[model samples]
Target: MKLSSPENQAETAVTSSLQAFLETDIAPKANRLDTDTIALQRALSQLNQFQFLGLRVPKVYGGLEASLLTFRQVQALIPRYSGAFAFLQTQHQSAASLLANSENQVLKERYLPAMAKGETLMGVGFSQLRRTHNPPLTAIPVEGGYQLAGKVPWITGYGYFQYFIIGATLPDGKALYGVVPLIPTPQPEGGNLEFSSPMQLSVMNATNTVAATVENWFLSEEEVLFIKPANAIHDSDKKNVLHHGFYALGCARAGLDILENNAGKKELPFLEESHQTLAQKHQSLSEAMFAALPPTETSFQYRLSLRVKAIHLAQRCAHAAVISSSGAANAQSHPAQRVYREALLFSVSGQTKAVMEASLNTIADYV
Candidate 1:
């Protein structure tokens, strides 16, 4: 939990590095990134060249090991240029963060160093465990390690990641996290990893999100990342409740950028005023969200409220951009249109029941 440096200085360094990369490389190609697999792949690689992929890994593991605020700053800045890259990179960063906390030295050594440099890439598939129902994925103890069987309803980065960390419930009411192949691979015991065609999502479909059936797949000890109590995600969610809001904040900025540009082009006084009003609101929300990051500083309920506010602002800002742009914004590739769609995705990116409720209430207030 130690920060890398003073907050302001760290923020500047991270923001400048990411902004330079995004403006120079991603902005010109933003419109095509939504469905261009090659463009997404190249973007992912180029991010690695700048060591962005390793932002969360420990410094000892050769990562930039940025402060949490700095890391979240990157999250907010990225979607301003390309939502697909923002969405895709977050998956890998999540995997790297999980691995960095592992008690399994062997697994840490195998992945952390390479992950820090983007020499290795991975994804995560465990959100299904959030549902309180018959487990969609389960693991049973075996001679060598554990046997995992069932379905992973959502696994992104199919063609982009070589391996991914899958989470499944254990009979003892614990959660088992282990590395599994991202590609299709048959097991010896009439078992296999089979994936459906990449889903055509409303946004970031280029990340190749797909469901998988893991039938009798054996997860060896060497590949095991860690095991935690069943409530781990719920607890983690409480602690990191504000984490995903930064993406929405970034998306809001994207909308404002479009709105400001259009205002200048059209010389509309009202549009300019609208941009300033919305920009100030976004700034206020941004500051409040950052100030509330310390777990002890705010109640979970308040943090949840801030998170929902961020979600609503993103939607509102994007909606404003759409309204200001007139007919041309209807183009399938319009930046405003894309940012609007991204707003929808970020609204529920890491939604829990409380988050879901809070977000709906915010929308209802607008209605």
Candidate 2:
């Protein structure tokens, strides 16, 4: 798909095609995907048909094997069309990437090819491993493998994904990652896995976020994805901290799209002028974040500062979109309201203690 090149702003065939597909199919019905499960599932299936489900999977696994820049571009591009679509599909893509990197050849071969082609869709629920409090979920060593017990606080895409990779803490503070069914599993080997109803949320509700109460859920060795030492996720979060900002970057674009559209519809000179100013700020932030990506010596603190800036910029752009949309933005179906809520998600998604402090500090104008 001509996915990668040296430049960040350079348009690739993949991104161009994705943009065309999104604008034609997804953008027009962004609001519907938030509330309509059938429409959202159809949109996801179309994405699979186009092979975008495999962007991060290795070529050996029937994936595009695109560079990080290419994947990040897709990350930014999708949310502009539909935040719900972006939010839902990313869970599958994350699972694919993890499988691609797994040492379990059997597990990788069993899942990666199908995952890449969306023949066997998957979701991920490892965020609970990042919580500072006692692990909401725990893993106990057993003869064949480990038994998972406790609650998986968040696992999006219930019906859309048949399976998901779960993370639970072990006694030594390490974590066990395993692929398990998304459905309520029977009490095989004297264990049970049950999920709650779809979580009611302000945004991306159609994605069917759910929680699981896993009681001694037997996980065979073949089902294990991988295991990591203590503090691995935290260290990884610090390294890839800027990745989620790509969503905010695209959301800023969504807000600007609405602001510019309203500027023309209302023919308000002040709105147009405000759009121009915000657009420039968005551009500067986008470039700085992109340049700080890979092959650069950008320090952790600097990248974090860029992330904080992107979060704040997204909120500002969303506010502007809401202001331009005027009183009508209060409607649930309003695009401005959708983009505003998306901005809220990006502000806190993948948040760590350090990111939280920085984001809150920026919120307080403590910059």
Candidate 3:
């Protein structure tokens, strides 16, 4: 699809707005985190002002309602300035997508407008779906709603997001999806909700990821989104791997840009050749993956392969960036080092068992 087509004009406008925002508001403070954490209030406020927090929400709800390809393009723009900001924004986009596609009109009416207006922010707590056996959280049917118990391993944007879309497995093996307020009023009355301190990570430490323990927390029908059987969830999830690919590609592109800018005159030949090769690969894979949207099993596998390739390319480009920067790259504040760490995060992000096994098998064949 031609990105410059009239159909994509709206998307182009949003992208342009995002670029301006990144250059002005986010870039200067992108590397400077206060106490190793972002002050999300200011960041979120800026995102709201730009209407970026609702980039994917439907126009009916007062959002820009960008296309999926356009959304991916926007995703690729942010990590160049701040990986932590990009990561956090991606989760909000995911949550908005879920809400946009939900079957519950009441829920949508209640939250979608608020989300679009940036009055409400949402996080995701569905990483437990990655577990192949013995899921961390479970659901039990009660008179009014489902009772939730156990822990959610990771939920980012803790302080910023007021709500989260959490998934739990039912007794009949279907997946139960619901939204719960992160900070309940009056302290949940009886210790039903609790959260751990934010985790410290090697990279993206400013995102403020946290773990939550829910003990018999109740979610009524009003709060529940849509429930899906295991097969349906798997089918939906397999198509999402491409989003990760775009993020990795963004990091790789950032590194390549840094490397090219810093290359000495004598080193320009090698840097130019490497840059062209990686850029061509990135464009080809990105086009192929987007063309395979509404992914079938075969397409899903193909996209997974592309995801692996993107991660590998990002790592190589990040390393090349560091090498080009030489001793200067070793500093804690070096952009090359930050890009390198961000590249490492792609390997584990959005990982499922099938993806993990496929990546391992691919590496084994290469070795």
lDDT of each: 0.89, 0.90, 0.79
**Candidate 3: where is the Cα deviation over 4 Å?**
1-7, 33-40, 184-191, 264-268, 294-298
Q: Which rank order by lDDT, best down to worst?
A: 2, 1, 3
lDDT of 1 at 108: 87
**Candidate 2, position 102, lDDT:** 88
Name the TM-score of candidate 1.
Answer: 0.96
Q: Give model 3's clash tally.
A: 0
Lowest-lDDT window of 10 residues in candidate 1? 2-11
lDDT of 1 at 184: 92
Report the C-alpha lDDT of model 1 over 107-171, residue by residue, as the tens digit: 88889899988888999999988865798999999998999999999998989998999999999
Model 3 TM-score relative to the real fold: 0.91
**Which model, 1 or 3, shows the larger TM-score?**
1
Backbone clashes in model 1, listed as residue pairs: none
Candidate 3 lDDT by residue in tens digits, 1-367: 6457664776687788888988788767766642245454577567876677778788899888887767877877787777888888788888988999999999988988899888899999987865647979999998888888888999988888899999888877788889987764223535377888889888877778888898888888888988888766677668677767778878887788777777644376877777777678767766765676553345667778887877787888899889878898998788888889888997678877767787788778984
